[model samples]
Target chain A: MKKNLSEDFSMEDSLEQIIQEKNLVYRPTRLMTGATLSYCPGCGHGTIHRLIMEVVEEMGIQAETIGVSPVGCAVLAYDFMDVDFTEAAHGRAPAVATGIKRLWPDKYVFTYQGDGDLAAIGTAETIHACNRGEQICIFFVNNGIYGMTGGQMAPTTLEGMVSSTTPYGRNVEQMGPPLKITELVAQLAGTYYVSRQSIHKAATVRKAKKAIRKAFEVQKEKKGMAFVEFVSNCNSGWKMTPNEANQWMEDHMFPFYPLGDIKVDGKLVKNVIQDL
Target chain B: MAKVRGAIVVDIERCKGCEVCVVNCPTDVIAMSKDVNSKGYHYAYMEHPDDCTGCTNCAIVCPDGAITVYRIKN
Candidate 1:
């Protein structure tokens, strides 16, 4: 049953208030409905989390889907998202997701991990999971440093950035070099799709939304392992405002970790999800 | 006589306490409360509704669509 409103008791002339109540460009969103997040004011995690949630909500998969979260600040991610989510051991999300997804093949399983988790400790799980060609979605958030436990140098840390662990800046002689996650993941034969996108600007956000949706679609079709590593920012951990952090990423990070698709199965065809 | 009927009302449950309302409001009538609601979203209220001046900037910026302010003549 639909509710309709009749003419109100009060009638106004041409001076009535005008409202642009329809065709909204975007809404705040309902996916992030719990605790006042502890994320710093300018962190990109919030925005990426919100985008993923919105996609899940729109896809109506939250009810049947379960997410494997990492031990980083994103460990509490399950609280922010409405989907049925499980907290994985630090850097073990890919393995956890692989196990759960195999058991409950009908359910949508995705792993949300950070740079430290994905590129460092869980590197084997991630590489092998994608190598084995498991059917699942992996949303890798690369913020360039350890965010939750403290700002420490991460595997994805750039060449000359100072972190709590590397104050003098990462020296290749000692630290080797920053790992390019997307490029590394692309080398895996099992991964069917891979793209690196960010949620910083509107255009990038739109593309990221689409790419995320595509990854889910690939999983739905059982194509193979799908991965999306968003070059997100950690304004708080990096000690910068939202705008400042975005600028830093564009100026410094983007050059080191350029954004785009590293691999894809060009032959497989399916209906493209509008927003993804 | 012109009646003061136009005012935006916020749905406290849906407000995420993001303060987009407080920050985006042109007239600056919206404010987030330190108290928590049942759903746990921070409740936003009309502190200086008088200063609204019929502007819907608060409603427009709300990501949750948790506000409804309108003018009604009786």
Candidate 2:
């Protein structure tokens, strides 16, 4: 067969070729609402949302999955994701997810939260739910700042990270150190799987998706709480271009919120074990 | 070695012109189109199709989920 009989095979032509040849490589997952996403350019929330939805679609749980959308940048996640979603007050997603999981034990229940909602306002709910082993999945998007609330410093904001409130960069002396919520939750015996992943690069995106899938699988097994943290970038809040923010995240965010599983099967992962 | 060919279809209107896909493409197969979409932002286009190795790096990094990649191995 002739590879390309046409000199100029435009994108449409290529798409048509793919349809005719049945060689589809990568297409948008069905779980996405297909509506234009509201996230700012280069925001990691969209990437994280797509990854989770991709996992949901692949696992064939679109109808059975219930997501708790917390107050923060991704509060409107339900508009983008096709799954059933319940809106929770600021930092209360885990508590809401706990209720849903308890009522519908067979359904896949997950909470999508941001650092401001998860690490700061929702810390108590997050810790308790995980500690109690709610049999739910928590997808935390830690962009280090309150992205939707005009770039306020979040609990996960790093030292020297500047925000509207911390105009001079976060001072460890005054503001205290950034909270390692993933590690804190991983310490609990009720947690079964805990991992921190990022979507800064293609390789990392693949890894993040895999982690999300694993977390969902753990939830399916009726295991304890499964938490996956996505150390993300807020380009608009950080006052940097999408590209620059990504570079900044790699330089600064990854060092503090290093990626990998902290715990698996109620024990510290090999990397964390070695660190100890 | 047989030449590896790839193609990417971008939803022009859905693209916010973040350039995440453009910068992340390993093979330089994509570029922002000179034409603007209805939203007045320049969308991405396959400026050079033959160079694409179908690595799917662009699709992976696109936050808007605007690009779809296809590959043909000869």
Candidate 3:
């Protein structure tokens, strides 16, 4: 804390200087509960959670917003976020979110889902929700493998990525290609906006937050389904340290999943969006 | 150009001591505290407080949302 000092300076002057020098510019949003997050150190889930709550708080939609928590690592999202939430079975968040959104068309509704929950078991629910043009936002956290279920191979796992189930690295010929679920959803005519983002770097976090805020705005506009997929890291699942996982993700994940808007305003995003 | 000063407050109890903030800080302003929090992890502190530019990079990278940032222009 900085203070003003002079022969004539009063305590009030010092207090005023302190207040001016230390005004808060950024902090955790009140939308998050005080409970400590259970995610492992450096897990992207925490960052994504903060970004979502920050967006919701900025939009002043906490009271009317309804979120659907999937059965994966984010299953306990309701406990952390200070908003209305409905629990969904594994991969069924889209279905649940669709129901809530259809009933209360004015309320902002979204789904917090993981790759395992959405791509593997809930693929149908996810595709159908977007296909039906449900007015909702879908926040998909794709950390490649199923972090909660002991590092099992998920539908979004990279072709050569190693998981508990794929001890020798995934065989592309046998396992098929990694699922580009976000691209698939973008291809549907119902989606209004679709983007793939990450939170590993500070600049990327800002972009991801903007993407989420745009998706929320789309929901408020009564636009079709807005899907924002966050390609994240799972340190424990990958058996790597937090820093190492982030480095590994940058080197490996970005090559395949990449990042940028796949669709915007119900039209295909320009091809120039792809990274070299 | 105006001089830049930055302030940061880390919720020690809420911090998991992951050090993501420490690593991401551009000015080397943050460091692991010698003292541990309730969770037995060494929380982060502003080791070089005067060096902070208030860029908010540490807060942006903090996974636990434990840090808040403030900036002053002089």
Candidate 4:
């Protein structure tokens, strides 16, 4: 039986012989470590992480890039990304990134933050960093809920959205309207480039990649702050399948938080979505 | 002129069976495996391998970055 099995194996080609290096089209960037991501399946955090790493690798700035991870689901970003990383206190990524960039003006510094950390706990830090025109990039992932904390309603939670804290859906009357932190930051004179994008579909992923690359380029040019907001989906937190969550995001979230450039090169773009 | 053929290698252990890549493949060449991986998720595989286009759509939408695409002109 052992001799027969060995003979059968010899008849089939090995995997290495089947897949040649020259035929490769796309592979994960080496900037990402081999560690298995901790994010739930279908969560946008993984895609966003890969995009950022791809940008860093493509631009040949792996050694010069510094990322400040926030206190949310992506706090373990340091584990997944093979780049220089520093952990920030709850909602203080912007402040931490500011200091890092100030000390090394030539290094590219950026913060990876979630809605709970940026729009809620770190509101003051976020505003001040942008207001001061810090030479850093802020990558905000707005999933509308505190995913790391078991689906609690965050400051950016949309109206009528349901979360663990908001059992009956978010009520604007009492809880106050959902904060538009991206637009608010774009209004500040310090921000150089500001854009809102998503990564659910292939086309959108391409656009998000461009936005990330642009943000880093803006920093390399010693420009003022560049803020990119990604309206993402939290499948586990939102209690929906990955596909359903993405569709729901398009149907509801995109209307509330439209995807487009709010500001570019220190100038505000007109025709901003005004309907609340 | 040769026909453009493509293939994809999926990291089974890393895949969570989210089905995002299955839905995004333009050629509809990918499908969920009837067998589950060690993690008990129905991982994706190229059901119609001859139909692949090396578009990179699946890799782009794969949140886990498990899919790698390769192309050959045959």
Q: Model 4, which residues run further than 4 Å from truth? A: A1-18, A272-276, B1-4
The list of candidate 1 runs beyond 4 A from truth reads: A1-25, A266-276, B1-74
Error of 4 at A273 (Å): 7.9
In candidate 3, which residue pairs clash?
none
lDDT digits (tens) for residues A1-276 of candidate 4: 235433344312323333578888899888889799999999999999999999999999999999999999999999999999999999999989989988999999999999999999999999999999999999999999999989999999999999999999999999999999998888888999999999999999999999999999999898899999999999999999999999999999999899988899999884544633
* Segments in model 2 whose C-alpha atoms lie over 4 Å from true places: A1-21, A270-276, B1-4
TM-score of each: 0.74, 0.93, 0.92, 0.93
DockQ of each: 0.11, 0.54, 0.52, 0.44
Instruction: Give one digit per residue, the lDDT tens place, for model 3 in B1-74.
Output: 22335678788998888777877888898898899988798889988775877788888888888988877655
Candidate 4 TM-score for chain A: 0.93
Least well predicted 10-residue stretch by lDDT in candidate 2 chain B: B1-10
All models: lDDT? 0.74, 0.87, 0.86, 0.91
Worst 10 residues of 4 chain A by lDDT: A9-18
Best by DockQ: 2
In candidate 1, the residue pairs with backbone N, CA or C atoms under 3 Å apart (3 or more residues apart, or in different chains) clash, namely A10-B73, A28-B63, A210-A276, B8-B69
At residue A192, what lDDT does model 4 achieve? 97
Candidate ranking under DockQ, highest first, comes to: 2, 3, 4, 1
Q: Identify the leading candidate in terms of lDDT.
A: 4
